[model samples]
Target: MGVYCSKKEVVEAQSSSFIYQRNRTTSLEEQIKARCPNSSANFEDENSHSTKHSSEGKMKCTKVCFICHERVRLDHSCTNQMVKDLEKHMDKDQLMDILMKIKQQVSKDEQSLVPYLHWGTNVALIFNPFTQGLQRTELARNIPEFSRTILARENRIFCIGGQDSSTMKSLPTIFEVDIEEHYRIKDKMNMNQARFHHTAVYDQKYDFIFVIGGMTSNSMGNQFKMLSSCEFYRVQQNEWSIMPNLKVARDTCAACLFDSQWVYVFGGRVQFEKRQLTNVIERAFFSRIDVSQWEEITLQGRQRIMPEFNVGMCHQVNDTELVIFGGKDTYNKQTREVLYFDTSSFSLIHRKSQAQSRKSSNVDEQLSQAKTLQKNYSTAQITVKDFRMPLEIEAPTSPFQIANNLFVLGWSKETNGIHLLRLSLINLNWKEELDFTSYLASDVD
Candidate 1:
């Protein structure tokens, strides 16, 4: 008589719960037979003819579980059960193979959950903040270059115009990096002008990036002509348009956007001048109609920051406040001073008044409100933050916020690699988060 088994019987045998009353010396297959009597079948034949017919029509039965076919059982707790059951049967190498598979699955899951910090340097560096893991990838088309201004939005990092290291020429190149896509970089629309050391600020509401004052020449080795001319890129339109020019022509000026409407340009040096730094603070107001001409902020003696160019690093803390950190002061010495600015309350009041005045047909009232708005720039406040940058770090970039804290990517002369320093908004404490490759600063001009 031939032995035959049904598909349903095999499934039941694999899924059956562990039988506590089973014999301990038997194999798992034998146990399955003990628990599931229907798994294997036998038919007794009284005649030789019946035995020949059964042998000709016999169906093959698979011994392995239908799910996770290599394992003996396919239960809800199969992972743990299989490991325990296989330890005695499997060799050391075979057991290690199973563990490695589990480890890979865990790593894949963690990658999907963690967020990345996309920082642009010669190449884009993607950092896992939680894991402190680092990765680097090249731009889709262009070679990694320096002097580019970086802007982060969502998971994308935009590298604006910068200088070409090899040819010593200013470039209009724009590269967009997607952090989640293995740090993949793709080229975007080039700027209307090629310049470096300019500040790029994004208007979140309008989806426009304003490229402010920078030098027209490469200036890698020598001084270049400073550009007061400014322009902006309309992200949705994929086009660039000229905007109101800066009042003063200068490069390496620190700039940030406030309230999604105001562009503030901090102190910077004049064209071709090394030692002289201007204390000029300019604010440009943006509205639906047009970009109002740039106006210099007027401040009394104690209200002004020390005259320094290229080092006025600041980031917006809120709609009305900003935190400024490490930068060179008037003495041309790098400082660890931290300061906060309470953006002009008068400006906010003027904005509200302007919105209300727009409904009125009185033309004179509208013009009067415009003049009042211009005069309120002096009402802004600046104060020192309780903590400063750690003494070892210097030449910090503008701050970028991740969550509750703000981080600055900086380099140290005393140390070789690039350092990411974090500042807590809650406790005002400074912490060294991670240190990585010096590739970020090695090729800087």
Candidate 2:
């Protein structure tokens, strides 16, 4: 265990539970003094102490991570400090050089390979495969589980808390899975604010995953009223803390990253004094400076005069652009519409979706591509995947069909099936199903 200090002890005006171990024999206090130099250092500065590495190819690396403030050698982690460099000062060419150099280093390293199992007929259904890691699920085998929503960081996938078969709330616990391992949940993580339709966003700049407002009343585990409050999890720190609540108590707001400085969250349902809820985009902001808290954005990003019909389940494509898809519009799930927003232009793009094709056929070549991607280019090719036109599939539908828009998912009551579904996006398509290349159920929380 490490001793605690006020936020002052660490830079960024935040106190962290971890301290660097300089010398095996040295105490924590001395180690801090040695590495941090003067106690009054600007811990948040990116260039506090940097290095230029001349590799065997003699290419110099200008980017560096000052271990004194935030440690970078632990894993393939980029702290808030590192993100600052790329976002603010690093030129495009320099960024490419650095990325290429780093990629080379990574490709040279050796790591274990995770095997995938065929748990079900489709990727959506929970792979009940036996495990070699953390062994447990929210409910017994009688209930079905699927990767309903995944908030992916650099290499980690936070399977946002989902529903189970019974009236009971989903395990109320979120699962953190690594993409390298068929996306196995690292450990069981609980959300104080019981969430269903809420959105979890990974802000690489902030190094935090912000979990925003969602509907809670109908959720079985949510004994509390519906929540408009917000919470955040610091990825590097592996901890969750509550921030300021959203302006409205809502479940199913559309959340998008805005200007890379704030999360533009809006348009969901809010409950009344009588437990009655109305659809409204609870406009608000969640920033890295104080991500745990939220502030309202009053610029009226809502396209709806009445928020009820406004879309929810949004795929926050970027800091400035978000794709709004299907959600409860007055009565049932809206499947006919697709909306896009450009925060820079403050323009909304709406289009009618066509009934797209499913996976055309189980081509051996396609399966080979999946295997090759897992082996050689999983990390190198970090592709953008939003709701896309349905992937063509000739396979028979087994309790599920591809979605027309950003198919925000919900858990099924049955245990044995109904896991995966396809969706239609702008020009391209990609499967949002579980990674069979490297996952197992026991490897989950």
Candidate 3:
């Protein structure tokens, strides 16, 4: 008659057999290697000569361990003693309770919105709130090209025409990057004109990418030319078509689409028979088939001073609202001026408060200029406020919007490195996201 054994005894026996068999297999492998010193079997991982061995003396596959295959169980005596020791030393309620706490300690990282900065043709800096509870951190990833105007839609990033940083020559090539896949499809389509420092806006309703005023190189690629010509790419058709040109030729300007019907361009260095920073604003109507002529509009506010090239502006939380801030003024000095443009009040002039009107002695003179400008054209109201930015940030470039936050990339004199700054739309406060001083030091080393 056969005698039955307890579950613990059965587990212990299975574990012992597995250990003995594993040791014996290793010993046989060492013997085979000793015989063939220069053969491929001398290597560690490959099973180059294992297939030739008889099944009886075949080595155990290291990948097929006890944890993976349930055939080999844990030794009951050893595991039981470990549990007893842990309980006695720590005085825990239960082993599972401790494990659950550990698992809950570190939350899994779920990045809903990712903002990317072009570091170079081979690397990119990504802003994320990491798993370790850092509010916002910069992660460097080796990736594709450098682009001046980049527009994001869903999980894809479109890199439009821009001058090559290495050669400083304009490029017509377009690159589409799938951030999730960590890959880029280059030369998606070439633009009609090679340009850089341009403004691009993606129209989601019609799937068109509108490329606006930008700077291009001359025939010799030695001198720069400001462009007033505009064009757009039909994403669905994979083709480019010319659009109406801007009245004011400028580069490094701000452009935003309002109500999916109107495109507004404003605030940049302009050359209208003379080289000077411009406060001129222009708007045009864009449709599925055709775009109207660009018409100048008057921004109703105090005597406005335009920011230098590379002004940072973003469509605020409200679709009709825009926030423009952080650019060098006409004096070539960085300014903290922030303009809140409300397009919902289009064509309707906002009268100043009685107190403000009383305070301003030249209210009638300002009203007369506004009336003359608004007679035959549309008008938009803007309120200017001075907001403080960190001292290190200088030369802020065109900003892009992701949800309610606007991120600007600029140079930092204090740290002597690149700084990514984030401005909150709700509170209108700025904070430094990440500084690349340490990374720059390592590169120098």
Candidate 4:
């Protein structure tokens, strides 16, 4: 500058001087503390007075009302270090008004979200008949205890009451799996009783899972007994209540819901001290959420002995007929036969029919009433028919229906494998769907 340098040279000299100062080496920690003064307590106290006014300019805080549990945002600009000025300026009446508005807004938001939370899509566990295997679905993590019961409701499968794997005794543990969520297992409230080989049915109207008869051994394990007792699990409340005992104690019985008002239990073995097996069909009537009772119904005009001690598969064909398949006969030999029951016939025996009969008095009126009653009686007549399946299934499990196709899961002696048999509702023809040999092999390897 003293030599009268040009403006470009003067600028370059200043830039060089600044670069020399910045290039001087320093400790990493010292450099950090130098550049970030407020990051440490030493620099904080050093700059406290200088930065006091700037930091006190404005601060945002949250306030909550103890009376209504409502929260609101507040701001303060006072520089006084010793006092909270936001609460002092608040008016109780104004805050209460704001609280009411907030509550209304929250209620509206919840109303908008309710439908999506309550409405769930329908899902089913799909099995491919042609492939004879589950369709790329996740298997449940835990295997069921011996003689377990499986029930389906609202796209979730509830597995309840079975023999414990560790103790070889009955378990009260309840597990559920959501079919829509890759069959993920979830823990549920335990049942009041530990049991196995029980029957469970879902009541759609009341949203309850009725757990019926099952067997459990004594503490000594030397004697085995069947359970005539029954209980129901309330889905909404996650609670269980005792239902009226079955007319007869049963184990390994088939149960189904009829007309949404009755649970029909079929052919199960009753064990006495002498181990005698008795099979009977009973219907449980549901009148209210808290009350249900079972009554025996006669199977009229049947020639074949009712399958006793047989693990038969039962399915509701309609309001009128239910088809039962594959249980052992009284001879203790597995049979390849199908049985059909006319369920509507049982309604004719109800108290309503007796009331209708007592209402008619005059001869002409009685005659006309009899004619109409006869027509209704003819339609209500219970018919049981035994048909032979193409293949014999030993102790078939429950039958599941999709569309018009009826699928029965059972074991076949010819193939020596667990097979799924498909029966067409249209033609009543039987076809082999899947074998579990390959599925089991893959699981083992």
Candidate 5:
């Protein structure tokens, strides 16, 4: 009884011992590293290594031009500039001679041309905004390949793999396009199923592109059905293989490969269920089954993170933050507010925008305004220089949609534009309201 200590005291003593042991462990690790410089495998971030290797491979495509199908001189390649120059002088009469020679020389090359970046906001008021600022642009082209499913590849930004509404089934064609240059489409791979509303994400660990549950049909259909299978596309082998079916049937699901080891699939519609939104997190590990095996995670925030989203589109800004933005809600109205999810707890971030009057038809008249006007308000002839609408954007891409940056508001009624509320995540500030609605009259319905 005299030697006995309460549970709290005992626990505190153990905690102190654990802290001492941890410090010693850290100290030993540093001393050993210094003593035997290259002995330890030294746990490395595999993602960094993979990224370096990927970058190295990228530099090897010496002769391919990612833009305009033009002949570009790579750093070390040898080409006769005189020959190219003289061709410019050759007249249309001799054009056929030049064409044949160029065609013959180029035919020997096997690599396909890279797509260039194309951007257009339909009308003058619209502007191409994403880093992969491409222009197959139409308001109606809302069902983009990249945005549709995991439609993006590693180097490539977005591709077309998800379903097409016209066919009324999942698409068999796999379109791969680089995100940097959003100009053209890549070689299409025929998949086992046409997937629309499926989840697509690149697994660097396995060097494979995996597609999760989506809708499919034998032929086109009037109404759609959910798919329960998972498939993988081998970029190197240029082949397709089917994997184990999902534990649950999902359509319009969102997928992300975070921690370089886990692919989380969540928030999908289950078959004909009207309000079926799942909070299940399917963890596909980087082990042998990176191509297939999945286990459901019963994490604390599964329900909160997934929410009860009906029409939700989410993109991972990074490992820590996954921004779930715009999608038609139960009411069919698009969203502007976003939920920022992390390891500890969820935090709410709000967005705002501001505009100031700068010019007026009559500057003198504006200055002549009543003295009672607030200094911030202005004088006669003063005008709102920038009509920046202070609004919130939900999902942010770059330029049009900054890559994993700003907010993406589907359609902000206030500005009547597809709003991208601008502000640094570090310092929340409103930039400008991007109005795509003006362009919608022609394309987006």
Candidate 6:
């Protein structure tokens, strides 16, 4: 009787295993039919359709379970038939809990994939001043308007605030170029006000571009008016905010960033009935990464007017000195005079001529002209002397400093082309860096 009981138990166990295997196979077949409705119609039809989709490169056999909504890739290697059986036994609450966990994991993964500004190997070498060579890459696109303000940050160049070609009016539109990515052009956020003849300076430490005084025609129908209000743009945030009003309304001024602490604006013109010019020097101080206040620097003794009408360039020579060049005087005459300002004393300390050469026979004549020029500003404390500039630099534009070298772009009257003039801070000598007329002409065409 004991032997008979043991044999009966073995037979019962084998039968139970066979029933479990049959149930699992049935559950898997049901799952496949539910997920792929086309397969429920006919197996041969489903196989042909899948073959056609695969030929078209559109076959996606993966399906989401109705119970848990989890995607499962279906293929011949699928050996987990028990998963379908287990899902059939699961309650709705258990399935919902599994889905919630899966959603949370997906959210975390997406958050971790947020892109950041890449800083490695993205520095652009547009032109080499020391080698007098260009990289031979085209601008991302044609500038929307002429006389726009250009500012550089990281591996990008931004062109902002110029006259619109269609309306012949000032534009607030901004454009950017990524130098590392084949110089791809992209439009960026617009400024609060449409401006032209404005100045832009980038702060590397904080990644801010401050747009200073310029002329805008928004208020007066066709006439451009000077603006004292300023604005700064945060690059990372892609937002713009108004800064404190400048101490004086100015336009067509020469501006420079000094020691990362102050932005000096010098020599701009205000037009009313007649054009009024100023030689005022004012500074906007950066406090806690934002412009806090502005202070006007008084020039002791006499005030010698600098340049106006977008004619001058300001290059910071050191922590305490700035060199200014090529601006129109009060007489509306373009002068090739170089002026040095002492920031410590807030004074114009030196004045010199920017002539390439002076013949021995013409020395007395040059001296006489220098004396005449000095007499025009007899009250100013300036030492007038003859200093030479490179012959290729003509109609000099604003000067920008990069890596201790000052660069000035201008048109060469002799070559009938555009030239880039570079001044090395170490040697304080000017040299022709590159000629960009042919390259620029091709782009314009």
RMSD, one per candidate, in order: 23.5, 16.5, 22.7, 27.4, 22.2, 26.5
Candidate 3, superposed: residue stretches over 4 Å from native: 1-112, 117-121, 129-146, 165-167, 271-275, 301-310, 344-386, 391-398, 412-416, 436-445
TM-score of candidate 3 to 2 decimals: 0.57
Query: How much is the lDDT of residue 197 in candidate 5?
Result: 56
Pairs of residues at least 3 apart in sequence or in different chains that clash in candidate 6: none
Residue 438 of model 4, lDDT score: 54
Q: What local lDDT score does residue 421 receive in model 4, on the 0 to 100 scale?
A: 76
RMSD of 4: 27.4
Record all residue pairs in model 4 with backbone atoms less than 3 Å apart, i.e. clashing. 132-434
| Candidate 1 stretches greater than 4 Å from native | 1-122, 138-145, 149-151, 180-182, 218-223, 304-306, 345-386, 391-397, 438-445
Give the Å shift of residue 97 in candidate 3.
Answer: 28
lDDT of 2: 0.40
Ranking by TM-score: 6, 1, 3, 4, 5, 2
Tens-digit lDDT track for model 5 on 1-445? Answer: 0111122222233333333453454432232233221111221121123122222211111122322333221221111232245347764336445444544444322111112121222121223332223233322223433233222233343443554445555566765444335434466568887766566665544566777787766663566677888887777677888877888887766566655566666566774556566666565665444444778755453233445443445544433555454444444354444444453344322111111133345545443432122122223212332122255332212212232124333445445556434433211223553444444445432
C-alpha lDDT values of all predictions: 0.54, 0.40, 0.52, 0.52, 0.43, 0.54
Alpha-carbon RMSD, candidate 6: 26.5
Model 1, 72-114: lDDT tens per residue? 2111233335535765787534544554555444433222112
Question: What is the clash count for each candidate, in the order shown?
Answer: 0, 31, 0, 1, 40, 0
The collision pairs in model 3 are none
Candidate whose TM-score is highest: 6
Candidate 6 residue 73 Cα shift, in angstroms, is 67
Taking all chains together, each candidate's TM-score versus the true structure is 0.58, 0.46, 0.57, 0.57, 0.48, 0.59
Model 4: what TM-score? 0.57
Which model, 5 or 6, shows the larger TM-score? 6
Q: Is candidate 1 or candidate 5 better by lDDT?
A: 1
Model 2: worst 10 consecutive residues (lDDT sum): 394-403
Candidate 4 lDDT by residue in tens digits, 1-445:
0111122222233233334444545522233234331223332242232222243211111122223333211121111211123226553344335445554444322111000000011222345432334633335455454433343434445667776555567767777765557667777888887777677666655767877788877775455678889888887677888889988887777787766678888887786444455557788778556556788886654223454655666766543667677766666666676666667653322112233446644445433443243222211121111135656775423465543456666666667766667765422336666654455434322
Q: Give the Cα RMSD of candidate 3.
A: 22.7
lDDT tens readout by residue for model 3, 1-445: 0011122222333333334453454432232223332223332222232222233222211111222232111111332344346547653234334544443331111112334444453444444432212122222322222245354445345667776665667778776655655444545778998887677776766778888887887766678888898998887677899988888888767776766688888766665235467777788998899889999876555534333434445443343556555555566555545555666643322223322445666645554444343221111221111135664344323455543356676665456577767775423447677664444323311
